[model samples]
Target: MMRSLLDHLLIVPIVLPLVVGGAMLLLGERRTRLKAGINVAATAALLATAVALLRRVNAGGVEVAVYLPANWPPPFGIALAADRLSAAMLVLTSIMALCSLVFAIARWHRAGVHFHPLFQFQLMGLNGAFLTADLFNLFVFFEVLLAASYGLLLHGSGPDRVKAGLHYIVVNLVGSSLFLIGVSMIYGVSGSLNMADVALRIAQMRDGEHLLLQAGAAILGVAFLLKAGAWPLNFWLPPAYAAASPPAAALFSVMTKMGIYVILRLSLLLFGDDAGASAGFGSHWLLLIGLITLSFGALGMLAAQNLPRLVGFSAIVSSGTLLAAAGFRSPAVTAGALFYLVNSTLALGAFYLLLELIERSRSYGADLLALTREAFGLDRLQVDDDDDADTGDAGVAIPAAMAFLGLAFVACALLLTGLPPMSGFVAKFVLLSSVLNPGGLTPDVGSGVPASAWVMTGLVIGSGLTGLIALARMGVRTFWAPSGRAVPRLRVIEVLPITALLALCVALTFQAGPAMRYFEAAAAALHAPHDYIRGVMAARQVGATAGVLP
Candidate 1:
């Protein structure tokens, strides 16, 4: 019974936030303090649950939580499964939620709105998306977040925000519709939406039947890619995310990661083996696509002048790195991808927060304008009747805020470049080690270790070059350039949240061993889905046998 209690921790992370969010909403938007207290407590509890579950799974393997709707069997019922990977994602979502909520506290109070309720709902969707076992349930969770996100993105009636919101809404709605179409086709073919059941059925299908399955998988991939902002379909991401309010933008970073998580899960579980062997639709294609995405994103970053826009483009590049490893499909790559996900999500979250401050202080779009009309040292402009009324009212100055901005910018650059003493570097190193030296891992038949090694080597080198260029362009202009521009002052609430996030990033880098262990266990579990299905089905069989004998 106690074990069953532990199992349900998987779903609690999602449910807790929804419950609190609903309550906060009912409080008529007046109990801001109470809402804050409830949301924070819930997030803290969720973080604890996620950490405990990850540790428990790392010590053992994937943890299964079967929530039978009305005590029914699977295939016709719903279940929520949590292994090391899901739990780690839950932890990441919780931390990001907590930090964003803290950062928005002042904004909410000043804006006189119930920010906590919407934020909590967003967390609910993210957590549920991570743990859901049913495809339909995943869609439901996605809607929960997307709907809340639309409101959050357009929270202020700012023109840029409204424009960005419309684009975000239209794109996501289309993506959601496509996702449903793919889900419907999958159900028509497989008769079961449970991930484990689907995998089992796919493994048993004959060759011709697999073509249908492959088509369904392709459609699903397109839907997720739309969300992941993969090469061709990601045009709306930069403008939408860049224009959102800062805390909202921070949460948006996690949104793209969810798309990556789904793609990785589906690709590995359904296509990793047979697709690589039988069909030629394997890691090779995905690797090539990832390369393209990485290059395109780097170009976007290089071309961007605004700080917020640059961060958005950098997210695309980070996603590319993650998918490149996904294309490799090695356990080492899986672990590396997971670590990179954490590192990038945390770093980007902090960067967005910092960008808000910089924009507010430095007048939003102050770029290096060409020094017009260079005059002699003693030349002074004499005011004429037709001269513009421009005067020396420079701007607001906040030295402490500028210092924090510099710190956050540097941290983001380090993360983007995969620099040492950061989790990004560790993630890349782990991925490279796995590909270059598969050690005892038995490669699939006809899969060349040399080919995989070179593929990974190319991705690593590409990431390095792209990072160097991006960092040199954006990082210098934002932080290190000797400009006497007045950046915005740091709000106490905003500063607290960013400080917490940066501290967490630092902690992750220092505790790479434990983090890697969780990631490895998660990767191992994902690489071997039989353990997952067996854990659930074996227990079901035993229950059936006991009922029959009795």
Candidate 2:
């Protein structure tokens, strides 16, 4: 009985939010505090469950724990599987959800009705996407999360937001259509929606079936690439993310990652080396596109005048980095990519929240002043002097508040730029080192590192430098330039979340050894997916033996 109960915990991350979200919807918008209480409790429970699942996966080694709904066998009934990768993703999602939800309580939650429920539903979708073992369920979860995001994107209505949200909605709807078409093609060819079963069938497909499968996979890859914000498909990302509310933007940071996660899962599981002829099928395209995306992101960051938009482009950079690394199909490279994923997501999310606060701190007069000077053809230097001239005795210097915000901003800059003494630096270092020399002491002198690896290394270094310069310019303008703006009043709710996220990045830096080890293990498990297949099939067997599944 205990074993059965433990096994059921896999579904809690999905089901709990669904229940809580539905209940909150019934509670109406007036019961704000009550709804908040429920959300907090639910999110806390999710974090705890995610951690427990992570522990179980780690302790149990490479075996994936399968949860079959209604005790029905796969290729028939729904299946949720928890392995090291899924568990880690779940934990990351929970952490982001909790922090974003808590931060929302400061003000954003009340800006619109059903915010709490929408938030919960979004969590439900994210958790579901991470855990589901079938392609169909992945689609269902994708729509769920996208629906929630549609609502959240327009939470605080402004012309900018509404327009951006409309574009976002249109793009995703198209992606959804492609997603469905691709899934249908695969289902028609393979007659199975189960990922493992699909893999099995694909491996044995006839030459004629190969063309259809490849076409379907290509369409599916396009949808995932769109979501992952790869170069040409990602033009909508920056504007939409920039216009979103702070908390929403923070959550949006992880949304792109979901696309990358799915791509990694499918690429490794379906078309890996085990799949004859299809091995490394899209590897070159992924690498080329990834590099292009990286270049685009760097240029976007350099051209960005607003902080929010810059953060949006940072997401692009992170996505490009992950895609390029995954394309390598090396365990060490994948591990470093995963580590970088976590670090970059947290830092970028925190920076989004911080950007809002910083913008809020600036006086509206500053904008007006700039416009007036520009219209009159006044010198920018003269405006700067005028602004600084009045700052002699604005108020008692709250050096501590200024210092805290400044320091936090700097930390975010360092992390985003992959500079030293932070997790970003460490993650990039690991990835470059791994790519350059896969074998540490004894290098593979025969083949040497691939030319692609060298290109990626240069791109990584160039992008980081670009990001550093961009961030430094923004920092100087925001913090050092005499804006004559008062320091933003910091709320504990808002400040705590940002501080916590940056602290986590710092912690990750310090604990890089263990974290890298875990990521490396997860990557190894993904590459050799036989364990995942056997574990899921084994669960079906156990259910059959107990006569609990038909």
Best by TM-score: 2
Model 2 residue runs over 4 Å out of place are: 1-3, 365-398, 541-543, 546-550
Candidate 1 residue lDDT tens string, 1-550: 1236765666677778888888888886667778788878888898898887767666654465444433446656676777677778888887887788788775543343667777888888988888877889999999999988988887655567778789989988998888888888878877789877777777567776677777777777787888888888889988988877778889889989999999888877766464433333446767777777877787887678777777888888888777777887778778877888998899889888777565554422342111001111112222243223333486434356667777777777777778777666876777677766564345555555677568557766675666668667766666667444544545688888888887887888889898887778788878776666655443342134311111
Task: Supply the global lDDT for candidate 2.
Answer: 0.85
lDDT of each model, Cα atoms only? 0.73, 0.85
TM-scores for all candidates: the values are 0.86, 0.93
Q: Model 1 off-target regions past 4 Å?
A: 1-4, 108-114, 272-282, 364-398, 440-456, 479-484, 539-550
Deviation in Å, model 1, residue 502 alpha carbon: 2.1
lDDT of 2 by residue, 1-550 (tens): 1246777899999999999999999997789999999999999999999999999999855458888876776667788999989999999888888889889888778877899999999999999999998999999999999999999999867677789999999999999999999999989988999898787777788877877887888899999899999989999999999878888889988889999999999989988877876677788888899999998999999999878788899999999999999888888889889999999999988998787666655545443223222323332222344455655757435445567778988999999889999999999999898888776535687876789989999999999999999999988987888545565556799889999999899999999999998898899999888888767655653435632311
**Each model's RMSD to truth, in Å?**
7.2, 4.9
Best by lDDT: 2
Model 1 weakest lDDT span, ten residues long: 368-377
- In candidate 1, which residue pairs clash? 361-487, 361-488
CA displacement after TM-score superposition, residue 52 of candidate 1 (Å): 2.8
